[model samples]
Target: MSAPPVHDPPAAGVVRLPHTGLQVPDARLRVVRCRPHYVNRWEYRALLVRGEQRIGHIRGPLPDVAEPGPAGVAGGGPVVSFHPRGRAFTEAELEDFAAACRLDGQGLSSARVLTLLVDEYRIEQMVRGCARRGGVMARCCGEGWVHYIPLRAYPRSAGQCAAALAHLERASGVGGPWRIWDGQQWSPLSVGSGPDTSPGCA
Candidate 1:
């Protein structure tokens, strides 16, 4: 028999992937409680806040919704609990979370951000609905410049990658564009004025 369609009901134990839709607006957070599991890692209960109002709770090992261990606790990983809107955490936001919890430097960098992993092969599976095939499709600044480029065309280093994206934006005359299917909705890419000598995020 032919395999089931992509949208067909998933078999037992199958997982649906998530996307990074947006950043939490005016976000403020505080860790109310924490339970340590592994070194530099903890399961936490936090409050998501906006201005002076408490908005929601962020309870996590991030994997609890996907694979909970005994008693509904999740196995070890970075501490993360996204908002209901499928938004991802930013580095600055994660730092804020870590600060409120008084986490050491090691723990500070362990906060997880939700994002889609894109590779040459995975790009094929991800961009299924696009008329194009093989390479990934991208659109920036709402300009009519929609096209597909292979993953190899993109540089791996942050400095190089940012430069390439900046060049692409200038060439296409699009300001601050969000590419399709990448799960990254951030604005147009640009590097700082000086040489980016520092090593990218560790």
Candidate 2:
């Protein structure tokens, strides 16, 4: 008799894998939430998840918006404003920031903790992507230019890893996505039915 034909299993809605490689699972198998921040600068952020665990996030900085110089304008006065102010955190800087946040003894609302981990991991992933693509050129103020040379890349910092686990522990108690206030109301993210559902319950 002939051997039975081999058959692949049906696709799973969600899958978990070891976090040691550069593999990203299919988007359709994950829960994703997108939020907008800074309308004037056009910043959009997204959170990614598999099952109930957050996997990562995406953050894109504002793109350049300088108009072409006027016709017949010689030299263009050195393109003084091509590069905008405000620097994104370097990998080392982000690591340090996360560490500081951990040690500061300042209590973080559950949402804030989640947001922090999401943003930091996302930034680290971007740095790794840039590095894998050889290198990237960064332009500033139209006149200033620099190349971002990556010495190392990481998916998660020590502080971020700790914070994520901590948030998850607390998250188990909170029910559903809800608002948090740091002197002001913050938008909700993720929803669940759990023990603690009140403000700052986690």
Top model by TM-score, which number? 2
Give the TM-score (vs. native) of candidate 2: 0.24
lDDT of 1 by residue, 1-202 (tens): 0111122222243221222221221223322223334434444444444445444444454233335433222365433444431344444454453332211111112233221111111333445534244433444423222333333242345786576666656666654442433333222233323322221111
Residue-by-residue lDDT tens digits, candidate 2, 1-202:
0111223332333221111111122322221555556756654456645456554554433224323443111144321111111343233432332222320123322223333334334434544466576532111111222112222222135564344334533644433232211112122222332232222211
Clashing pairs in 1: 141-177, 176-188
Cα lDDT, model 1, residue 93: 53
Q: After superposing candidate 2, which stretches have Cα over 4 Å from the reference?
A: 1-43, 50-105, 135-202
Error of 2 at 85 (Å): 36
RMSD to truth, every model: 18.5, 22.8
What lDDT score belongs to each candidate, Candidate 1 first? 0.34, 0.31
Candidate 2, poorest ten consecutive residues by summed lDDT? 14-23
* C-alpha lDDT (0 to 100) for residue 49 of candidate 2: 52
- Model 2 C-alpha lDDT versus the unseen true structure: 0.31
The collision pairs in model 2 are 82-141, 82-142, 83-140, 83-141, 83-142, 176-192, 177-191
